[model samples]
Each structure stands twice: as structure tokens, then as C-alpha cells.
Target: MKPLLAWHQSLWQQVLASWQQDHLAHALLLCGPQGMGKAQFARNLAETILCETGQACGKCKACNLFKAETHPDLLQVEIGEKSKIITVDQIRNFIQYCTLTSSYGGYQIAILNPAEAMNNNAANSLLKLLEEPPAKTLIMLISHQPMALNATIRSRCQRLDFSRPDKKLTLAWLQNQLSSTQDAQLLLNLSAQAPLAALSLAQDIKKRGELFQSLNQLVTKKEDPIEIAQQWNKHNPKQILEWMNSWIMDMIRYSLTANSNSINNKDSIKTLQNFAKQFDLQALFKLLDLQTEAYRLITAQTNIKAQGLLETIAIAWHKN
Candidate 1:
């Protein structure tokens, strides 16, 4: 298996130590933001527990099985391909799987990724499994939003937080992963400082630049909000909203601090500063509120029209 990221290594060692002492929790909730390597950590932990030497020794039969993706004692649960939520039936299946004996005569492991994707019924079903966990079984619940889970479910498991890593460490690691010259700091900023996410955003940096141009045109009243909204409707609503949020927040930041270094959109510092000067703090905050609401509505997959939402936000920028 691949090694854990540098930020994850310390936590890996802590869990390893716990497992070595045979004191690892039966159900562990790996809580963190997306792209923090929580899923990888859970898989590594499962492999370690299942391996013969409890070290994830690749030469061992259990390790080989895991690598081959045929580990009988392991179960991975996630939302179905066509579905947004993990159904109760899926939770029940995993519960049944956990009840069986470990084929390797060792740990029986189940990994529920993005555990918040479980609907109420599915969460309730999983709660029963947590309440009376089977012997020598490990249930790993991975969640980007832990608070969205049932309180009782959260209370039952030991939670391991994978919060943001050290800035220097994260930047260094991210810089090395880039194939070309890209500002690791900027990528980090755009991704909320998540390294893997920063890396993923590298591909979209050019697209972001294009979007920023459109935003500037709208803010300067050089472009029609309706036309821009129609153009933006072709893109991913969530990502479009995220980029807009960042730009509007930078405007707010510049408006308050008047420090270019404090803003995320360093490439557009002059534009943000110029725009910030035109709007009072309250107007900027209102614009931010509109953008934030659009973001929330899109993320929640509400029935609201994306184009109209974008148009409203665009018009706010144009009118402000």
C-alpha cells in the first residue's frame, strides 16, 4: 500500500501504537475536511489490523488479499453510484457482513466513507451496530461533516480529527507534487488549505482565471449579469460559487484590512482593491451574504434554479 501523507504520518503512528497495545476502539470515527486523507488512514489502519504481524506487511497473505481487493474480512460502504445517500439496506448488508467470522482469523473491518451520506434510516441501522459491536471487529466511519451525523452515533465512537496540517509542511508537500510551476500557496488558499484538494485544484487554476475575468467584467458593469449567468450555467455550480465566494471574500478582506497580502486572490489584488474601494463594507458584506446563500443552496441540492441564483449574485455585483 502507498504510504500516508506527511501530515497523516503522526496520526498513523498514534493509531499504530494504540493497535499495538490492543486498545484500539471497536468503532472509530475519522472526522475531517475532504482531501485530508482520512479515507487512506482508515484503509491503512484496517490493513494493519488484518495483517499477520499487525504491521500491514505486504508479504503476508492478508496484506496480499487486501492489495488484491479481495479481503474477506473487510467491507467498504459508501453511497451508491446513482444515489446521493447511503440507504438502510446498504447499512444492513454491512452489519450482516460484520457478524461473520474473520476469514483470516483476525480483525473484521468495515469502512463507511463519508458517513454523513447515510440517511436517517441508514444512520439508525449503523447505530445499532455501534451499540453492540461484534468481537474483534473494527468499524471505521469516515466523515467530512461529523456534526451532520446522529449525536448518539458520534458519541459511540472515538473520533480522530484530521484538521488542517502545518502551513509550511503542507505547502512544501504540495509544491513537490505539482508537475509544473504553480503557486502552492495560492492552490492551498483556494482549497481551504487541504493539500490533496490543492493538488486537485491545480488543473482548474486556468479555468478559475477565466472565471475571475468574467467576475471583473461583471463588477465593472462591462458585462450583462443575465448573459454572464447563462454562460456560467454550463459550468459546475458548486465550484463556480466557491470561486465567487473567494473573490468576494477577498474584496471584503481588502476593504477591512487594506492589506493585499491578507487576501487569497493575490493574482487579482489590484482588481480587488479597486473594486473594494467602490463599495462600503456593508455593501461588500451584503454581496458576500448573497454569494454565501447561493453556495449553500447549491450544495444542499435545493430545487432553486442555478442560473437564476447565479444571475442574482451577478446582478448584486453589477449593481453594487
Candidate 2:
């Protein structure tokens, strides 16, 4: 298995200790924010558990099978690209797989990534499995928002929280991954201190810059809302909304505190300051409420018309 991130070393050791003592939980919830690498941690743990030597020896048959994505004993369930929710059918299949004996006579592992993506019926199906877990099985649920899951599911699984890490260690690790010229602190701030998210921003600087430029143009009345909406529709709506939310929050912070240093988007401070002065406090609150609802709708439903939502949000920005 690939090694866990440096910040996760202690947690990994703890899990190993539990396993060695035969006290490992049948169901584990790896809870953390997005981009915190919880899924990778889960995968590493699974590999170690499934390895014949319990060390994830890269040359072992089990390790080869796992790397090839053909491990008979490992099943993964997640929302498909065309669908927003993990359906009951997928959970049912996982249950069937659990009924079988492990091919390698080791652990039968199932990873449900973004576990909250499972619909009510799917979650209920999985809950039954959790209630009466099979022998030598490990069910790992990787969740960005554990609160979105059923309380019963949350209660059944032992949690491995990845929320907080030593800031100095994280910053040091982040610095090594980024180029010397990049501002690690600024990237961290933009990503809310999620290292992987910060790295992604650094890697996609051009796209991020373009997005900020579009927002600046919108705020200055230099671009049409409908046109920007059309352009953004081709990209991932969730990411678009996230960036917009961050920018709006920064603008609001500048308005309330008159402290540009406190804002997340330092690169866009001047633009935010100029825009913040023209926005009404009540209107800003209304926009925030609208964006929250938009995020809810996008997350809860499949095949949403994000263009219309973006256009509406854009028009709201222009008018404010």
C-alpha cells in the first residue's frame, strides 16, 4: 500500500495497533473535510488488512490484485458520473458480495467513498449490513460530511477523524509539494487549509485565475451574466459554486471588518474591496442565502440545470 500522508502517520499507527490487538472495528468511518486525503487513508488501511503478510507487500498476490483493481474480496461503492446518488442496487450487490467467503481467505473489504452520496434506500440497505457485520469483514466509509449520513450509520461505525493536523507539519509538507515561487500560505488560505485542495489550486493556476477574472468582470459590469453562465456551464458546477461562495464570503468579510488581510482571496483583495463598498448588507445576506439553497439543490438532486442557477446568481451579483 502507498504510505499514508505524514500528518496521518500517528493515526495509521493507532489503527495498526488496534488491528494487532484484534480490536479493530468491523465498520470504520473516516471522517474529514474534502481534500484531506481520507479516501487514500482508507485505501491504505484496506490494503494492509487484506495483505497476506498484513504489511501490504507490493509483490504479494493480494497486493497485485488490489493494484490491478480486481481484488475479489474488495468492493467499492460510489455515485456514478451520470447519477448523484448511490442507488440501492449497488448496496444490494455489495451485500451479496459480503455473503461470499473471501477469495484469499483474508479480509472482505468494502469502501463507500463520500458515503453521504448514498440515497435513503441505499443507506438503509447498508445499515442492515452494518447491524450484522459478517466475519473477517471491514466496511470503511469515507465521508466529507458525516452529519449528512443517517445517525444510526454514524453510531455503528467507529470514527477516525482526519479534521485537524499539526499546522507546522502540514505547511512543511505543502511547501515541498509546491514550486518555490508559489505562496504556500495563500494557497492554504484559499483551500481552507486543506493541503490537497491547495495543491490542486496551485496546479490549476490558469483556470483559477480565469475564474477570478470572470468574477471581477461580473462585479464591475464588464461581462454579461448570461454569457458567463454559458461559459461556466461547461465546467463542474460544484467547483464553480465553491469558488463563488469563497469570493462572496471574502467580500462580506472585507465589508464587515474593513480588514483585507482577513480575507481568503488575497489575490483578489482590491477587487473585493471595490465591490464590497457598493453592495448593500441586506442584499449580501440575501445572496448568501440564495447560494446556500443553490448548493443544497445541486447536491440533493440529479441532472440539475446548473446553467440557470448560475445565470440567476450572476444576475443577482450584477444587480447588487
Candidate 3:
């Protein structure tokens, strides 16, 4: 496996130690927020376990097959492009894969990312496999929201929690990755301190700035709700709503405490302050509630009418 991120070194050591001691769990749940690199870590562990040398030696047959994405012993199950849920069929196939011996006489590995994306039947099918895991098999379940998974499923696996990392180390690492100077702290705050998420936001600064500008125009009555909604709906609706949600939260924080430091969007502090002056606290709270509901609705149903929901949010902003 390639070297893990610095923050993951300690956990990697712990997991590697377990493997060396022959005490590694057959199933592991890697739980953390999105963009913390849990998926990458799980993949690395899988490679290590599957390699004949018990290390991810790039020259080894197993490593070569894994790098080519054709390793018979490695199975990765996730939601399909057209579907939000991992179906029972996928789980059934995974179970079948687990039942077989490894072709390389090494560990058979299965990685299920965003494990909560499994529907009830699919999860139940997986639960059965967990209940009677085959020997020399390892199942790595990566979850951004582990609480959404069934308690039984969670309990069945040994968990590797990746919830926290030292902020100073993360910021230093993020700064090194950028070619130009950037407000690493602001990006970190925007991403709830998830380093990879912060990096993604930093890379897309222009798009985020445009979204903030559009939101500002809506607040100033310079843009029509329907028109803005139409434009935003052309992009990712969920991301647009998430930005709006954060803005509303900032407005609320500034309104209550009059502290600019409390705001996540440091670049938009002045605009948020102006917005706070114009909109009442009640209206901001209502907008927040609406955004939360919109997020839930959009996430629950792929066919949801996001334009309508965005329009509703825009109208509310105009009204307030």
C-alpha cells in the first residue's frame, strides 16, 4: 500500500500490528466524516491483506491485479450510478465471493463504501455474512454516517474510528498541497475540518465564490428566486443547498453573538452581516429549517424537484 496520510499513520500502525499478531478482525468498520480518506485507508488495508508478502509490494501478482482493478479476491460494493441504494443482489454476489477461497491463498477482501447506502434487505443479507464470516476473509465497511447503519451490523465488526485528527497537522498538510497561498483555516472551517474536503473546496474556490455571489444578489433583491433557482439547479442541487445552509448558519451565529469569528465563511462576513441586518432572526431560523427539510427530501428521493425546493428557499430569502 502507498503510504497513508500523516494523520492515519498511528491507526495504520495499530491495524498493522493486529495483522502481524494474527488477531485482525474478519470484519472492520471504518467510520468517519466524508473526505477523511477512510475509503483510501480501507483500500490500502485490503491490498496489504491480499498481498502474498503480507505487504503491498507493487511487483507482487496480487498487488498488480489490485492495481489493475481485476483482483478476484477483492470485491467492492457501492450504490450504482442510477440508484441510491445498494441492492440485495449486490450483497448476494458479495456473499458468494466471500464463500470462495482466495485464488492467491491470501485474504479475500470486500469493501463496501458508504455502507449506510444499503437498503434494509441488502443490509440484512450482509448481516448474514457477517454472522458467519468465512475464514481468511476480510470485509471493510466504510461509512461517513455509521449511525445510520443497523446496530447489529455495526456491532458485528471491529470499528476503526477516524473521527478526529490534529487540526495543526491537517492545516500544515493542506497548505503544502496548494501551489498558491490560501486561507487554509477558512477552507477547513467550511469543510468542518475534513482536510480532503477542505482541499476540494479550495480547488473549487471560483465556483463557491459564484454561488455566494448569487446568494448575495438574491438577498439584495437583485436576482429573481425562480431565475436563480433555475441556474443553481443546473449544477448540483445538494451542494447548492449545503452552501445555503452554511450561510444561514453563519447569519444566525452573527445575529446572536455579533461575533464575526464565529462565522464559517470568512470571505463573506460583510455580506452575511448585511444580510443579518435585513432579515429578522425568525426568518433566518425558518430558512434554516426549510433548508434542512429540503436537504432531507433531496437525499431521500433522487427524483425530487430541486428547482422547486430551491425556488421556495429563494422566495423565502427575498421575503425576509
- lDDT by residue for model 1 (80-191), tens: 6546677788889999999898887887999998899888888888888899999999999999999999999999999898876777888889989996568888888878
- 42 in model 3: Cα distance from truth in Å? 0.8
Best by TM-score: 3
Give the C-alpha miss distance for residue 98 in model 3, angstroms: 1.6
Give per-model TM-scores: 0.90, 0.95, 0.96
Give the per-residue lDDT digits (tens) of candidate 2, residues 1-320. 77678889899999999998999999999998888888889888888888888899988899899999998889988888878777788888878887778888877999888899888998898899899999988889999899999999999999999888767877888999988999898888777677888888888777778877887778789999899888878887787778878888887888889998867888778887888887988878777877877888897788688888888888888886
* RMSD in Å for all candidates: 2.3, 1.6, 1.4
Tell me the lDDT of model 3 at 15. Answer: 97
How well is each residue in 152-207 modelled by candidate 3, as lDDT tens digits?
A: 99999999998887787888899888866688888888887889998988878887
Residue 45, candidate 3: alpha-carbon lDDT: 88
Cα TM-score of candidate 3: 0.96
Error of 2 at 190 (Å): 2.0
Name the lDDT value of residue 136 in candidate 3.
90
Give the candidates in order of lDDT, highest first.
Answer: 3, 1, 2
Give lDDT for model 2: 0.85
lDDT to native, each model:
0.86, 0.85, 0.88
